[model samples]
Target chain A: MSQVIVVTSGKGGVGKTTTTANLGVGLSKLGKKVVLIDTDIGLRNLDVVLGLENRIVYDLVDVVTGVCTPKQAAIKDKRFDGLFLIPAAQTKDKDSVTIEQMQDLCEKLKEDYDFIIIDCPAGIEQGFKNAIAGADKALIVTTPEVSAVRDADRIIGLLEANEIEEHYLIINRIRPDMVRRGDMMNVDDIIDILNIDLIGIVPDDQDIIISTNKGEPAVVNPKSLAGQGYRNITERLNGNNVPLMDLEGNTFLGKLKKLFTKKQ
Target chain B: MLDLSRIFGRKNNSKDAAKDRLKLVLVHDRANVSPEFLQKIKDEIMQVLAKYMDVSDGGLDINLTTATGEDGKSRVPAITANIPIKSIKQK
Candidate 1:
C-alpha cells in the first residue's frame, strides 16, 4: 500500500527539509519507489538538498496546473534508483497552489509510488495546510529546545484538529553531552511534553552539515550518526521493529560493556 | 578526580527553568487563552463582583489552572479565581 507522509515542523530551521530528503533517499534505498514533493513554493530548497537543483525542467506548480505531468516533473536521483523529487516553484508564492490541488497531486502520486513524502513549509499557514492535505501520516521534526518543542506542541494540536491520526515525532539535533549535563531537554522530557510516539532521534553531528552542504542525503553517508537515525526511522516506517539509536556518546562504562559483550 | 561543577553546580539551571516556563505558557496557548485575555477576564469579573460586594483588589488571584478530569489522565484547563470579600453590601 502507498503511504503519503507529510514532514513538518511549525518552527523554521528545525530540519524539515533535511528529514524529508534523507527519508526519501532512505526509503528508496530499501528499494521502495518514493517521490518527495517540495511544497514550500517560493522558499523551495529540497531540490538543492538532493543535489538536483540544475535539472528542474518542471516543478510542482507545473504539474498541478497541468503544464506538465507529475511524472515529468519528478527528477530521478542519480545516487539511488526509485527516488524522485518534485521541486517547488521558486517564482510563485505559496498562495498559487491551493490545498485541493496538493491533495489531487498526492492522490495521483499514490497510484504509482510506494511512498509520497511532502516537505511542509514552516508555520501553520497555507503552505503547511497544502502539504498535509493528502498525507495519511505526519512526521514532526523538532530540536531539543523549549521554543521548538512549544511550536511542535502547537503543530500537534493543529494536526490532531485536522484529523490526521497517524503521526510521529522525530527529535533532531540532540546533544548528548549537553543533555547529560542537564543543560538541554532530554528525549524523555520532550516525549512527556509532546506526548507523541517518537520515530527517531538524530544526534547533533558535524557530519550532517557537511553532507547537507554537499547536497547528499546523510542516510547514504555510512559514517553519519544522524544517517543511522534516519535509517532506523525508515525501518520503523516499514513496520520493522528497529531499536532507537542511543544518543548518549560512548562513555567508559558503555565502552567496557561493549568490549565484554563482544568478547563473549 | 570528579568534576566539581557537574556534582555541585546546576541547582537552578536554565534548562529546568525553560521547561517550566514552556509548560506554563503552553497550557494557556493550548487552551487558546493569552495572558492579556486572562487579565481582562479577571478585571471584568472583579468589576462585576465589586458592584454586589465589598471586594478587595489586593488579595485577588485570578489565573488559569490545569487539573485532571474524572478520567484522571488528561490535564484539563480550569479557571481559578480567588477574590477577597471584605463584607456583603446590603441594599
Candidate 2:
C-alpha cells in the first residue's frame, strides 16, 4: 500500500503547492510510483503548477462523486512517466467532497502507487480536514517569517489534537544570506519554535518562480539549488541519511571536512 | 546593586523589551485573559484576598511558563503567580 503524505500549511502562499509538485517529481525520479493530488477544490492550482492543467479533463471531485473513474481523472505527467496528478475541481467548492470520500479515494490509489501526496489548502477549515483525513503522514510547510512560524505552530497543535502522528516540518523559502545577517530566522530557530522533525529546507531561489511560471517544478532543473534540496529530501524520505544541503557558503568547508572524516 | 551601565545597554534593553512582549502575550493566551479582563480579575482577586488580609492594589504578577514532560512530546504551560506578603500587610 502507498504511504499517503499531506503537504499543508495553515497560511497560504508558503510554497505548499510548490513543495508538493517538486516532491512528487523528486520521488518519481527515485523510481517510486508517485501520485500528487490537489485537494484545494474550488481554488485549485496544482494542475497549473504541474503543467497538467490543459490535460485535466476529469478532476478529484469527478472520481469521488462517481462521475468518472479514478483512472480517468488521474493525469499522467509527460516529464516523468511514473508520476501522476489528480487535479482538484476548479468549479466545485470544497463542500462537494467529504472526508470519507477522500479517504476512500486515497485507499484505492494506494493499491497502485507507492506515494500519494496531497496538496492541502490553507487554513484549518473543512478543506484542510478533508485533505488530511486520508494521510498517513503530514509535512507542515512554513517560511522563516514570524507569522508563518506561528501559523505552523498552530497547525502542529491541531494535528496533535487530532491524534495524527508522523508529522514533520519543511522550512521553505529560506534566505541564507538573510539568516546570516540575522534578518531572517534560520533552520534552528524555526525548529526551536515549531518543535517538529525537520524533513527539508528549501532555499529561496528566483529560479523557482521562473520554473513555476513555466509550469515545471524547480526540482527537475539540475542547476537550481532548490531542486537539489528537494532531491535530498526525497532521498531522506526513502530512509537515506543524505546530509542536509549547505545553503550558506560558510558551511561548505565544514560539510566537506565531515564528508572526508566519514570516509576515513 | 546591578551594574547600571550593563543593565541599560542597548542589547540588554532590546532583549528585555522582546521578553516582556512575549511574556505578556503568552500569559494572555494561556490564561484566556485579556488585558482588560486581567485587570478586572486582579481587582476581584485582590478584593477576595482583602477579606482576610490587607492587600495592595496592582501588586500581583502572573506569568506563563512552559513545563516539559519526560517524553519530550508533552509540554504544558503553567501560570506562575507571585503575590508579595509585604504588600498584603495592612497599610
Query: What are the candidates' interface root-mean-square deviations?
Result: 6.3, 10.2
Candidates in order have lDDT scores of 0.89, 0.81
lDDT of 1 at A191: 91
Q: lDDT, candidate 1, residue A251? A: 74
Docking class of 1: acceptable
Q: Local error of candidate 2 at B24, Å? A: 7.2
Recovered native contacts, candidate 1: 0.43
| CAPRI-style quality class for the chain A–B interface of candidate 2 | incorrect
The TM-scores of all predictions, comma-separated, are: 0.90, 0.83
| Tens-place lDDT digits, model 1, residues A84-172 | 99999999999989989988999999999999999999999999999999999999999988889999999999999999988999999
In the range B1-91, model 2's lDDT, one tens digit per residue, is 3433233223433334433444344434544556686567667776778776765555678555666757986556665667765434445
Each predicted complex: what DockQ? 0.33, 0.14
- Which residue ranges in model 1 land beyond 4 Å of their true spot? A253-264, B1-10, B35-37, B51-53, B68-73, B85-91
Best by DockQ: 1
